[model samples]
Target: MTIFACMPVFCAIPTTYLSGSAAAGGTAVINSLALPGGFVSPAIMGWAKTTTGSFTSGLYMMAALLVAGGLAVLLGMPARTLQETR
Candidate 1:
């Protein structure tokens, strides 16, 4: 369900900054960027669990990254893009 919502936003990114035609390539780039984190996140979480005996620190770190990414999108994207998306 979240993927349903996320893909359009994913597409919107390139459409916003570049062009509608760039979306497919942009999505490929975005997916590739996400690949590293997907691999690294679980290992980091596992390390946190082993070293700290809990997932709290790992979860907090992920949450912080989420907030930072959202902020970067909000600040970096053009104001008109926000209005058009709505």
Candidate 2:
């Protein structure tokens, strides 16, 4: 519940940057990629909490992952608008 609180923000990213069928594809790709993380995160968090006696370790791990993903998008994504690409 807490993890998914920002879902609306997540949903908006592809739509903002993409257009037409590309937007649909982008959304599909993003959600598909997130599927595994959705499954794994709870288990990992649970384990971390059990080990550390708190969720802080799991929260830090997730934060690190988010930061790494953001950096990846910044560096690897092409520097062009949808119109330019078209």
Q: Which portions of model 2 miss their true places by more than 4 Å?
A: 1-19, 80-86
Per-residue lDDT of candidate 2, residues 1-86 (tens digit): 74467668667878887899999999999889989997889998999999999999999988888778767765765668534757
**TM-score, every prediction:** 0.74, 0.65
Positional deviation of residue 23's Cα in model 2 after best superposition, in angstroms: 2.8
lDDT values, one for every candidate: 0.78, 0.82
lDDT of 2: 0.82
lDDT per residue for candidate 1 within 1-86, as digits (tens), equals: 64356657756677556766576788779889889987888998999899899999988877787778778878987888679879
Specify the highest-TM-score model's number. 1
Looking at candidate 1, the ten consecutive residues that score lowest on lDDT are 2-11
Q: Evaluate residue 67 in candidate 1 and report its C-alpha lDDT on the 0 to 100 scale.
A: 71
Error of 2 at 79 (Å): 3.9
